[model samples]
Target chain A: MATFHFELVSPEKLLFSGEVDAVVAPGAEGVFTVLKDHAPVMTVLKPGVVEIDAAGNKEKLFVRGGFADVGLGGFTILAEYAIPVAELDAAKLDADIKNASEDVADAKGDEARRIAAEKLAQLQELKTALAL
Target chain B: MPSLKDLRNRISSVKATQKITKAMQMVAAAKLRRAQAAAEAARPYAERIEKVLANLAGGVSTGAPVLLSGNGRDETHLLVVATAERGLCGAFNSSIVRLAREHIQRLQGQGKTVKILCVGKKGYDQLRRNYEKNIIELVELRGVRQIGFDQGDAIGRKVIDLFERGEFDVATLFFSRFKSVIQQFPTALQLIPAQISANENEAAAGGALATYEYEPGQDEILATLLPRNISVQIFRALLENAASEQGARMSAMDNATRNAGDMIKKQTTLYNRSRQAIITKELIEIISGAEAL
Candidate 1:
């Protein structure tokens, strides 16, 4: 059986790197999976869940926006913010979402509003994943 | 002549100073170790990412994205100055700010419009006195709960926002690259145009080019990839700064401790000589009085 090496990294740290039979990432458009010898694909990752199937085990990660490169050896996901599902504190994340959402609504100017909105969107994605 | 109490007071002050500096050196040394570790750990990941990006970029055409395209005008320039959040890292912050100042002066002489964005508080505080008008943003991470991607993303978003608005033709990031505890170099890099080429032939470990497939197409991917690269690079700078700062602080405090020790030695020597001279005078007076009696 062939195994693909899957690695996820952020600027601060390397979140995960392991050999997996398959992996799925939420891309800019939608979710896509990569298997051994799957065609090399590169795309932007959206704020969503990334599920990795390694050695008959499944692991899920919540990532903020980033880039993913699926190449000859394996797949690499470069995320701005990548946290394991197990690490996600649902209560805290919910509070974060609520705060972020309120900040967006109360933002005075367009620039502040956009940044606030983006934060809200990312937190909301985490909320969805943790709720599941 | 100084009183014994004064001498004692001076001795205690010097001793206190020595203790403080010695303790600071020790603390800085520990932090420096952790900082160096973090910096070193980031290298492999950074190198791999750069390699992958470089390969993909090499395959893509020059006219693919604005980041890759580089508008062909160096008229307006944006300089992102990243420095340490705290002071006392001997010349670490000043050296970077100095380099940025020189760059700004040179650009101004050429009649180029320049804007500045400061990442750490120290840089902003230092440069703002002169470049207040040019400062577009100031992001201080001193109060940050943690150092992570979210901070980088926030900074990256600002840089991208400015770029998309066409505020500058080129953007440069100034930072100190950590080499060792005693050595750090201020680096000025072009962030815009995504000119940084990642490590070459790194992806070859997996075998041949192997025909890459684009999901949302290469062009769309590049558009986003280029922007994200800027933030990643900025984040890298912050981490490097964090490490370099600790290294600088450790070395600086070590030197300070040594200097303080030398100063205390010289003062003590002076005090001892003066006390000996006074004792000799008093002994002479007592001998002369006994002869008269």
Candidate 2:
């Protein structure tokens, strides 16, 4: 199978970069997979696992909200937070959920409250995924 | 004239100072390497965001998003000044503060309400001497080993909140742009009323803009993207400042070490001369006493 270039970049570091067989991203509306020669599309990412299948090896990473761009040249993921599923810290994730809930409670307006709620929901989902 | 003993003490003190400075230089050099790597690593993401932004911008009408179009008033200005938490980094902190001060003066002179938001301790310390009332908040990242996106996101959210609440009409961020170890200069970026420069336009035009499609329409994506752009820009600035701070410290320590070496050399010369003069006088006294006997 012909492979194309793909890079997964986070603020902390570049997590993955190489030719991949297929890349699956947890998009806002649904989960989608991209392969070589895919049409260019920009999509928002949700807080979930991004699975990358490179040759025979499979890698899954937990990512916070960010964006994925499938361009003609290659596919790129610009994530706010990206870490291996195994490296996810349960205690810190719990603390983040607590803080986000507080933000929701202290939120002043509808928009702020909605945003905070969305963040809280995402953290809760992550917590559930980890079974923490 | 002072005795040779004093010059000896002075030389020893200078040597000690030189050792300290040399050590600091080495430390800064090591730190600068890490900081530079971090800053460089972040560039691709920042550039990619801008590219995506430019592509989306082409579809939307100008002045549509609140972040992109802005609130359309320049009456109130908030300056987010970023500097180093610690000092001894040459003019790194002072230069940022100086630029911010001048900007503040210019804004205030125009009868505009100017507010200061300081990000680092050194900047707050300098600006407080003159513009204490103008300062709104002082954010100190004192013990943070590495600058993170969370910090940038918080600051960006604060600026957006202030804008949404009608607290400020315009916002500007000040930080040092790191070029090299010997070269770093101050740059002020306007955060609020995000302006798309010509370079960004070209970058998007050169990319695969024609092929990409937005999932939920252009305007909707822009609404969320613009706010994230602010956070990304601030994150880049913080990283640049980190690199610049270390670079400045390295150079400053290097100069101090050289200056200490120079002072030691001058003191050693003086000490030797003084010792030789004292010995000659003693010999003359002994010869005179022998002649008189």
Best by TM-score: 2
Interface RMSD values for all candidates:
1.9, 1.4
Q: How well is each residue in B166-250 modelled by candidate 1, as lDDT tens digits?
A: 8998999999999988999999989887775444345444445547767677777766677767877887887788888888988
Which stretches of candidate 2 lie above 4 Å from their native place?
Answer: A130-132, B203-211
User: In order, what fnat does every candidate score?
Assistant: 0.61, 0.57
Off by over 4 Å in 1: A28-30, A92-132, B1-3, B197-210
| Tens-digit per-residue lDDT, A1-132, candidate 2 | 778899998876788999999989988878899999998888888888899999978999988878998988899998988888878788868877898899999999899899889889988987887797
Scanning candidate 1 chain B in windows of ten residues, the lowest lDDT window is: B198-207
Query: What DockQ, on C-alphas, does every prediction get?
Result: 0.53, 0.67
Rate residue B153 of model 1 by lDDT: 66
Count of steric clashes across candidates, in order: 1, 0
Q: After superposition, how far is residue A67 of candidate 1 from its true place, in Å?
A: 2.7
